[model samples]
Target: MERPSSNGDCYLSLHNFKQGGLVYRDYLFTKDSLMVFNSFGDGPISQSTGAREYYFFPRKNVIPQFSWNSSDRRLEVTATDGNVVFFDYETTAMTAASNLLAK
Candidate 1:
């Protein structure tokens, strides 16, 4: 079966399978590109990218540096004021203010 397209001011649910997973498409920081995080049974599964490193600043942890290691596939949240939090990308949940970056 085919799904009907939205004419103009129509809206679709975030969980709409036809339109794809929940989209943060217009999310402020995500304006550059679409960053889709796959939610696992428990929560977020993992983040995948072909880059050397990625960085971010979780809304709650926005105080030193937010960087990730692509080789090891890890996520690091840091503050500009010098606070830091680290986690393995393949094993951590998505942060509230997480921002994706290129190598």
Candidate 2:
């Protein structure tokens, strides 16, 4: 998700993966670096839901270099750990009603 903010535009990405169980990673992309928060099961399972309690890890800053394509349709991100990720993206047009509401 992308949204306008007072400082600048903010981007958020959430990813889920399976280790022994389900784990969630939340990333907040900022101007200088990307902040990451991780959450996973830790405690004992619940009697009703049969799910373990969730433990959220502290946020960490991961520096990444961002490059946008000339057409603005593709984005290339290089992380400090020498990992590269490419994303294909597009913009959404706001409806007239939404634009008015935003104003």
Clashes of each: 7, 0
Task: Specify the highest-lDDT model's number.
Answer: 2
Per-candidate Cα lDDT values, in order, are: 0.34, 0.41
- Candidate 2: where is the Cα deviation over 4 Å? 6-8, 16-22, 44-103
lDDT of 1 by residue, 6-97 (tens): 54221111222333444322111120122233332333434421212223433332223346679867655443323343444543533334
Model 1 misplacement above 4 A: 1-65, 93-103
Candidate 2 lDDT, 2-102, residue by residue in tens:
45457665543423333245344445544344455545555543421232222122322344455666685655554343344455533211111111111
RMSD of candidates 1 onward, in order: 14.8, 15.4
**Highest TM-score against the true fold, candidate:** 2
